[model samples]
Target chain A: MNHLTLALDTMGGDHGPHVTVPAALQALSVYANLHLILVGDRPTILTIMRQHRASESERLRILHAEQVVQMGDKPLHALRRLKHSSMRLALDLVANGQAHACVSAGNTGALMTMAKVVLKTLPGVDRPALVTALPTMTGDPVYLMDLGANASCDSQALFQFAVMGSVLAEQVAGKSNPRVALLNIGTEEIKGNDQVQQAARLLQSTPHINYTGYVEGDRIFSGEADVIVCDGFVGNVTLKTTEGIARLLMHQIAQSVKRNPLARCLSWLLKGRLKKLFLQMNPDHYNGASLLGLRHIVVKSHGNADELAFLRAVEEAMTEVQRQVPGKIEARLQSVLLEKSC
Target chain B: MNHLTLALDTMGGDHGPHVTVPAALQALSVYANLHLILVGDRPTILTIMRQHRASESERLRILHAEQVVQMGDKPLHALRRLKHSSMRLALDLVANGQAHACVSAGNTGALMTMAKVVLKTLPGVDRPALVTALPTMTGDPVYLMDLGANASCDSQALFQFAVMGSVLAEQVAGKSNPRVALLNIGTEEIKGNDQVQQAARLLQSTPHINYTGYVEGDRIFSGEADVIVCDGFVGNVTLKTTEGIARLLMHQIAQSVKRNPLARCLSWLLKGRLKKLFLQMNPDHYNGASLLGLRHIVVKSHGNADELAFLRAVEEAMTEVQRQVPGKIEARLQSVLLEKSC
Candidate 1:
């Protein structure tokens, strides 16, 4: 790849072009061989570029997107009506091969829907699952899929998710045949609802994948598994709960340290370690949500993403393009789904 | 409350009486109107009791329970076969009214099973739900009901759970007209599965609860509502996810902060706040899982609980007893169920 170009949705996220533009510039500086196709309001993009003292504004081309997708708008309505929305135009770039990959921090539903409609799922790919990487206790990040894409699921979809998630883990984490576990109420085969039970049966019999049986929500943090798979509903709930609890703890710690003189002394003792830990667990550190199993690479940034977070999403896109993740997923999924039909 | 005699299932947790004994003695000093009925292997309890020079030991009585419930043993098997288990005998005390409530950090299923068979559900209460209090962002604890008692729930059971949970919130959190929300995939009335949608419709039209419509799992910590009602399966998954995420973040924080000197310095500055936050978030501080809709109070302590956690369970029991929580729940439920019939 001489100079791979990624279409960055600059008008996306809570901070829009102000954050996305700077993050894109940072990525461009870090990777000299990378190019960016910035999609947003022309004036805002130019203003942000000027503020960054970016001379290579020519290298980062701005594509005017007259409309923007608001986070609160109905996903289907926004996708259907706002054809010129920054997120839609960015995704269209990938669909039409104008860019190597697409990254967006806009309305998640709209982005996913547009990507699915424009880029379409790989043949035999049942659902384009959203995968979020979370930092584990062992300092390695684990790939957790179906964070909020599909609320309801079937056995086949979950099995496919396992395959896609496993491939991503292997490529991203460099763990060959990473231990993949089906998130369930218990580790027993008999545990969980019909969807999980069916998925377990399919996963156990499926070859070419290392199935680690069921893993409870508690074990997700223990760094025991590399790839955790569950229905979208459970995955979404788990991810959000994790975020909420982290915030709650962080806030409480701040309150406690500021409360008393003795605590102040203790805080002084542990200051360096705590901030490092807090930063490590920061959501921005693992900001990208990969739209796995699609024909093209599409990473969803958090809706409220800042500059650093959007940059992380760009890095994710770069990594995916370098790894040819979509092609790998296509090959693995084809074999699995083809074998099932045979 | 004249010298309330309580049975501590000393051999119940992973660390057992080592933690439970010290915690109980500490609690004895704190709660002057408390007595002990230490139930476990006589020699072990005696050894631990001898270490603590607490004068309350004179009032301490040991009941030999040779068989203990293994954490991994099946719920019903432990309940039926382990007739001589300390956990069982502890429940026996409650069944016979010798003790007001029983606290154990043993197999949760066995505790629930034993409680149901022993104490029975309150009148008009079809099922006994498990309720756990999670720290909310609003600086108040939110009561999430049916955390895992029943895996599957119908519309009626969920509604009843809302009633029971709301009453507990009002009685416990002191929130009058405690806002009740049905946990769903989305906040919209039309956003969830058939079960959740039906529950939302019932909650919306129903007059008893201060229903706030549907709430996604993310909103649980947002503190937008006081009581969140969901089927046992969803609630259990959400609760475990919250726990798993908290543990994940804490482990990450500890590992990162301890790695370097500057990070350690930052950790020192944040240690007081961190400890306070972590301790507050510790399941131990809010260790009790109340058996709701039951005629009597039954709190499920963490199976791996230490002494401080068990002592907190005792305090929780005292709070319930002093507040007459069961009676209030019973009265509220009776009135609501009666209204439903009409």
Candidate 2:
């Protein structure tokens, strides 16, 4: 049937099997030929599988992974000690080519560490970055890279992230030479810290890139640029703050609407629209952040991600596989690495 | 009536006299003894003032200045050359005690430099920091420091920012022993870069402040902490990103509501509450980020701020005057500085 199978860490995430199981079933239903290596506490997956009457259990193979990484545990500690952990086992499946990719809604750091140790960096990648797509005001997605992958980075790393982010956007989003920007305080050439300024210089002179110069934080969601690049430290903070602020705003709107009966009636009328908006802002919709430059695909879903988010993450991996994005990124990055050596 | 006059820079912001003049008049309406020194192009301010039929023209002293600081000009270059600029003149009034504080929706960097050079830093204060209050999910505002004042900072600088942020929160928000937190990638003490880790060590052991330990960016708007401290670089990015994401989400909500007649009707009903929520997200409501550590009070309004924002900034200055927050912050910081030198 020319379909692909993915290994999912169903025991991961806050909702665990409740959400993961349903999402797995949903994904399987969408692609009749899709098989899932359900890695988790086997009993839990079977119990969840039974609820869905997933006759496709024949396609869904359950692997007994006795442990799941807690969100708070150190990544190194979790990976080094928990060899049979669900996330680790999932990565092994992908590494050994038992599955095309590994997806987890667990500890992000632990996922990165396991993937790195198991699969290793693609030929010439020095560091792998986590890249996620954010919806812009123009209704198009903007890919932001190094979103908490490496908290401290130099100019060369940022430039590489831009290259990787751009390649992914082109391959996955199907954009041709997406307009790229380095996130900064001001749009001026002279604005931002040393790393951002240095990256800007490289991007400006780089021949193959569609460099758009510096973009202020305010313009990030405006669709002013297609690819936003920054050090993992800033990108991580920016992404988290954006989510927090959205949640805070949504909560505030709910409280204000409930304060009066007239407003309450209006909220009911607008409930569907508001839900859609919330869904659009949902961390799940953009849940899967890919670890770019890895030899094999590894997508880290949010720890508290729901079924919908996990489903999207699995879909993201499938898309990556279909487009051969990882291979293309590796080739482009390898050339840069070669040039640097010369 | 211990209230004092404030010098308002009218020829500032993307939408200048149109918004600034009305906002100044609005501020004067709230405070009975309020006097405004409208520093800008005389003809423009007069025309707007006349249109508003502002009865307090006598109280509204227009100090005509011929020069203006364009947003693109370098901060140091503008501050040095544009000596008679409206923004510079406004700060001069405050520095000379002709006004208790200066307010400007002008070139932020220029205002900061001019204020620092003119007002000088409080003894034992290394640099002045810009502080703003962000609305949190708990319905109370969390005070965040160094919202783009100093780009690069040391451990001591961050520690001092925490102390200053704590004092301002307590004095202004009536928060007793405000919980202070350093923004980091992770909650662990050893998780962040060297500066963040070192800052954590000192903040955790500080006696004058109620240190709550490190908080991730997601918790900033959750109201889990009272005072959030970070370097100017991180703070600026966080603040702007919050605004950008909120705008994106709200716009998405509006678009979704218009997709169908039923949803559109409901949107209209809940429009007031939604608008109120949006207003709370307004950057201007949180305008007048104070330059703490300055010997004299210095408040910076957003360069693209409107009249409503300028009025809110005046209110912020008034709050500082009543709380005498700077004095308290200096006293605590001096003791810490003394200990360090010893």
Candidate 3:
């Protein structure tokens, strides 16, 4: 395999270098051909690296950044004032061809805005989308897109999301012809608003895409479709609601186990199985979401991700880098648009 | 307390009389002041009633209807052609003052359309929203509204939903001053579409509602706010996503426990505690959703609800009827509208 270099936004997440440095080292141990350019304040990165006894080898280097983008800062504010922030510097490395991809556990809005401005959008794409892979019952991951990049979308935008999402699944998920469906309240053609209905018509008539009909939210994890498309508002809310419910249920289980003496005693025996189950369902395991439709691979890690979660994000970026996801998306989108115009 | 009579559409859900009949009987046993009028095909309902050894009393009666609304039937089709259908007849009973409330586990769009046409909207209300109570970590349920009543809502529509939802929380949930917030991708005021921002501004300025700025989807179960408001599209997707994730997690736990011998043994010992926890988080416990802003109370049950789930819906409707939710909403909305106009 060829060498893959990823620009690390070392001062991005809540704990910054403390989390990113350990995660980067762990990822390096897994991928022998991996290279990293850590972007952050130089002294902090160096100190953490020394603590881990990781040296600047041929595959790893540190790039100094002067400022940081606070999680609370607005996207526009970060763009204007924090031009030299770790997040922006890392994105610049990818745009300048110095890194194969970039990974950041930072403010989502800021990362999206800066990445779009720096890397630019792919050909025939107006706005980029946040796409993530979720575990499903069939053991195949489903790719869900437009996870909050654009708040409100029209029929045309939704159509674009479908195209982008299908390309991602085909190239990255290794699905030959990924079935794509619109997310709606009901499965009927006349169920949702005019925008969704119009998008559905377009998808149905398109020959280049395997466009399935509507899929309701309750069936999202059933693995019935490879790609599920929706407007950003709906997608974001659906994603977060799923996370919230998972957390709530786990909490309930723990509380119940503690209250009963028999359950508490039994919990000790079931600890290993319970741990494995919780690990599979943990949101941390699914940390990184690809910023699709951009000119380069940009993976956004969850802001609160710890070392293991952040390592998963680095692995996600590495996979995208090896697959050349953006190039595939651009080529597919151009052909689809040309066919539509004809 | 005055006797609360409920008109139940026995031919509504997937199993029709099988689920609704037993659920109604169970509900009658729970509430002494409860009365039910079962409307469906006479022979089928009678057969089920006799099998359950339930005979008509002063509080429980049978209202036969010649036709039934198929679960897949369109709302407009049901309204135009199936005037005497069981679902339509139940709404009519509420409209004609024979029943204080109506409960149906039927097609949602059809039920909403028929309810609005028969009962009409309350004064100054343009659309009725679907509002349901969700269990929260704080042990108090948070009321979420517009869970698929109107798919695409404007700023004014969202404002109306907030008003109606607040009234429901206060009257039925028994909160004196409900803290209501708009559901958005982010908690920032500028995070969502223009309609949401405008609605937030209106909510903040309104005197009656305790309008908190914004609530993100993940924090919805945190119990930070008493009421969460959004368009039907977002609300529906969020609610369904929560259900899906809960189902997925439970399935994971069951599978993992079965795979390990120790875990399987522990699961048997922990069965009682696990059962209680599952019961509390069960979607069936939160089945009924009220159609707020309607002139009379109309509760919608899950189409797939079993006997216990349907019983919970009946209990929910009884709670609303005893609380006089619609009457309270009418009075509060009139004053709020008057205040807004001035």
Candidate 4:
């Protein structure tokens, strides 16, 4: 927290430099002890900065990255071919301690692959799970993990995700012994697939984790549990499904208001409150997903994130850096390991 | 259409006779050509019928089914032990040609299992997938299938779902050459698990299916495709998550309206529209899911459905019966099979 330097993948996502550069300036203004290294094409980054009436300083450095990872590029291609890409360079900066964290509004698969290749995993971890914060009705944000990280994870991988998620909930969300539940179609013992049942067994045996049993999708926002863990495939689909409903409802309100005179009159007066509700309900666009169990912090923003969203992603990275998320997860794992050995 | 009869599992849902009896009266009034067999405790059904100022007649028969499949009953237990249960009896009526279709709001697992055991699957069908109609932006409801039927499905099962879904969309939703999409994390060739990728290959090779490639969860309500197919696990979670969001948004609106005076005034004026929007947005509660690929029609209402929702389920069963959904699916499969042999 003394002085934080974070790298930005300015040549990623749909908007690229247009969003990242403005977000970088905003982050610099918010965090007095913050430094941002913009990694992208030199001319475009500089031009965007100039357009925003800003210039590079000690706290703001422009690091030229020649290649840009396209949205359609496969993970393997991004890993093997685009070595000097902005996404890769930003992750490289984090790996070598040039920055405390890295933020990207890039293709998720590419970033996941590159971050794993560059920073490697924390010791005793096989895979890094993608964890995102979701708002609950109880005024606490529940952390859901493995959001399209490992499509078909083994029981061991799910157990590890539970540990990492617990660490996140405690360190970042500031919850004590956060209750963790496995996301399943049903809550009964007879429910879920083999891997989930096996993971439930593993979680039950672990002393440090406050393992609540399985939770169905309908209970996700009920605040019955602080953290929900599942294989990446299910998690990703569930997260996006939530986002889809948010979009659907927003669209429905708009269309309905247009047709209904009474609703239209009310909509004009409650515009601000309604906009905030829509924004607050949509977590993927407003917040970022952290790749937990990595050696360094990396937050993945939505691909089509606007300036405000990308800035929120940078803030997410800064918060993870301040909380030392990876360090705490490592420590928690060691203690769990010790308990098992005893 | 000829006279249609639907066997209702009067004691299956949480509300038992309270919801089903009132709903039966409504269905009888709506469809003059319809006859209903209410299967439950005879005394209770008679009492509820009397409450509605209706008595047993040729159009409405009360079949005594003493055993009730509880909401928490296991599928195996219901299948083996609860043969006289109202859910099983209703299914039995359909099997013996006493009823054209059966409607239940019992435990989904029990209903699915008993449905297969009594009515059986279509000759070439591996499993009977759960299909539901979701309201879309195009005003025509899109069909989604395998909503917790087979938790982990092979490519073959997924392909079968696609064929059945196409038939439903064409016959029921009346969408010609209905576009079918597989639900996945990304739309790339390298994205998704082995099952989904393999399923995509199968769909691409099949001539009858208008496979539109992969679609993410966020594109579900966009009306980009007529049918979306997924394994039971992801499909079930996606659906319940949608329901969860609907609940959360409704709760938020109520809570927020209470806090803001401007919003409160708007909410008062927009009360009817808001209620309709919320009800329309929550499909699981508004509509029942049909067990596709079955020999007979079986519509599973939401467990906690009210009288209106139960009435909708009765209407859904009647629609399928009039459309001869099972027969149409049989013919479509026969044609596809003939094409394959060529």
Q: Output per-candidate TM-scores for chain A, rounded to 2 decimals.
A: 0.95, 0.94, 0.96, 0.97
Give the Å error, residue A90, model 3: 1.3
lDDT per residue (tens digit) for residues A35-54 in model 4: 99999999999998999899
* DockQ, candidate 1, vs. native dimer: 0.45
Per-candidate TM equals 0.89, 0.94, 0.96, 0.97
Candidate 2's residue-wise lDDT over B156-210, tens digit each? 8898888888888888888988999988888875577788889988876677789
Better of 1 and 2 by DockQ: 2
- Model 2 residue runs over 4 Å out of place are A1-3, A51-58, A284-287, A337-342, B1-3, B47-60, B339-342
Please tell me which predicted candidate would have the highest DockQ against the true structure: 4
**Highest lDDT model number:** 4
Candidate 1 lDDT at B252 equals 65
Q: Which residue pairs clash in candidate 4? A: none
Q: Tens-digit lDDT track for model 3 on A1-342? A: 479899999998888999999999989888899999999999998999999999888788999999999999999999999989999999999988999899999999999999999999988888999988887878788888889999988898899899999988988889989999999999988899999999999998898899989998878988999999998988888878776665665677677678778777778777666656555553534558889989999998888888988998998888887888888888888888899999
List the lowest-lDDT window of 10 residues for candidate 4 chain A: A273-282
lDDT of 2 by residue, A1-342 (tens): 276879999878888889888999999889887888989998888888888787535678988998888878788898789899999999999988889888898888888888888989877577899989988989788998888879887888889888888889899999998898888887777677888888888777776678898887778889988899987778888888776776777688778767788877777667666666665653534558899988889888777777778888988988888888789988777776666566
Give the lDDT ranking, best first.
Answer: 4, 3, 2, 1
Lowest lDDT sum, 10 consecutive residues, model 3 chain B, at B277-286
TM-score of chain B of each: 0.92, 0.93, 0.95, 0.96
Better candidate by TM-score, 2 or 4:
4
Model 3 regions more than 4 Å off: A271-287, B271-287
